[model samples]
Target: MDSIPVDFQWLGGAAFAIAIAVLAAWSKVFGKKEGPPAPKVQEFYASGQLADMGPVKELVESVGLVMQQMVRTNIALEETSKGIHHLVQAYEKHLAEEQRDREIAEEVARQLKDKR
Candidate 1:
């Protein structure tokens, strides 16, 4: 018995062609049948009743309120930072004045000791 070598490319092409032919025949025998017509958009709104957009309006108003709150919070934080900066400046000034007073007192003590 002699076995012939088969080329994979030719075999794949023949298999694909047979599969396509079978699918075509199957669809011709049991294809989808046409049903009733789909309803049109005009039919849904034929009674002149508009779609309710109350939820959309409420969402926009809520977003506006959140933005306003964010602005107010930013302003408050800026004021707080400014107040902290002023407090640090005042504390530095107080320390400088206290050092100057201590130096003046030390000079006076030195002068009195030298006179004695």
Candidate 2:
């Protein structure tokens, strides 16, 4: 017995197209509905204009003062680091000078002993 050959590529394309069409129809029927129009920015702010914001304002001012103090402290810390670096450099220079003096004294003693 001989059987007819089926075209699987055409069948697959038709199945994919039907799946996409069903998904589109389902989304249109069951997806979220549009919400109300958003309020305008000016209107939104105007609605809350009568609310008291004194505490919020004072808190912001206190934060500003703290930030200023932090900036000053950072500047002082940088200056301290610079001063420490200078002190380190000076100590190193003093040590180098002492080493050179010791070397010179040793060389002089060696020459005098050779001459004697």
Candidate 3:
């Protein structure tokens, strides 16, 4: 049987080329889409638009305050829910005790009527 000679150098080069082609195709399919870049602080200063920072700062502070208020409200709601749950349990226990007492009293009354 005649043996076919394999060239290692050609195989290595082909493998590298295929790897590069795969990477290029993958990037084209999944890379971030390009859009207009945001204006930098330097650009804003250069255009005499530095006054915009004041309103932006105020907006950030207001948002922070709102977030704090929401956190406090959530805590209050959780506490109220716990208190209501405890109250419901206590009321159920009281009702059960009253029902037992009423049943006992009715049984005693029936016994007395039978004795007469």
Candidate 4:
């Protein structure tokens, strides 16, 4: 195998240097021309309208709160129903006791009248 010719080696080095120079100049002139700077983190939080969700988020949050309140109210109503059932049972027991007492009194009175 023959060694590379000296002239060809020089030409190759020149071509590589020229390619590097052209690429650097092209990038300086046209590659991604600088636009406005990006917003800093704090500035993004402070200034952008997108960060402020206005009434839409509030409405959603209020709806969530209302749903929770409705659930609570339903639970309270269920408890109230249970309490009313207990009260009704208590009243029924009292009425049954009173009815038994009246029957006993009537039986005693009838027996007393027969003896007289």
Candidate 5:
């Protein structure tokens, strides 16, 4: 009689199946619930708001443009004020020169009248 080698593959598969069934039963009895996040995770996320605001890129560009315009306007205002100040100074100098000329003419007329 020729001896055939025993195949233990079937026994191994049956044992693996039983072990998996036991684990499934244990998990159903004692494991955490399957659907939602844990309470701790939910609580941690509760303080955060989801930003559904439209288009971040456009928002940034608009804000940047506003700031740039404000800066340019400020600079223009400063330059305009400087120009006004220069004009005021020139007007004052012109007034002073006109007053001095009037005084000199008055003195010359007085001297001529005294000589006559």
Candidate 6:
């Protein structure tokens, strides 16, 4: 195996260190700083105004209204589905009755032809 030159390795390491330092310095100068935000609860309490607070009650009420409407719509949909099922059942019964009546009429016609 060929041995790598030591001087080239040292020069490469130095260049890497310089690049890391430059990046660190640039980030410190221009990067956005992160910290805890101002306390909204403290601001609202200190302001001594009820209107400044978050609308927790209003949000709850709106959610309740939405749930109520959803329940009502679901019930209406279920009733409509049941009505369609009943209509289909009635139509099937009517067809059966009509078929039976036609069979009876055919039997009477055959008896009349035998008499003639």
lDDT for each candidate structure: 0.89, 0.90, 0.92, 0.91, 0.86, 0.90
Candidate 5 lDDT tens digits, 31-114: 866797666644423656334434666799999999999999999999999999999999999999999999999999999999
TM-score comparison, 4 vs 6, better candidate: 4
Candidate 6 collision pairs:
none
Off by over 4 Å in 5: 1-54
Expressed as tens digits, the lDDT of each residue in 37-68 for candidate 3 is 88665677798888878998899999999999
| Cα lDDT of model 4 by residue, 38-110, tens digit | 9766554566765577677899999999999999999999999999999999999999999999999999999
Residue range with the least summed lDDT across 10 consecutive positions in model 4: 42-51
The true-structure Cα RMSD of candidate 6 reads 7.0
lDDT of 1: 0.89
Rank candidates by TM-score, best first.
2, 3, 4, 5, 1, 6
Error of 1 at 69 (Å): 1.0
- Candidate 1 residue 12 Cα shift, in angstroms, is 40
Displacement of residue 85 (Cα, Å) in model 3 is: 0.6
> How many residue pairs clash in all the candidates, one count each?
0, 0, 0, 0, 0, 0
lDDT string for model 2 (17-98, tens) is 9999999999999986989999766653577854567787899999999999999999999999999999999999999999
List where candidate 4 sits over 4 angstroms from the true fold.
1-52
Q: Is candidate 2 or candidate 6 better by TM-score?
A: 2
Clashing pairs in 2: none
lDDT of 3 at 80: 100
All candidates: CA RMSD in angstroms? 7.5, 8.0, 9.7, 10.8, 15.3, 7.0
TM-score of each: 0.52, 0.59, 0.58, 0.55, 0.53, 0.50
Off by over 4 Å in 3: 1-48
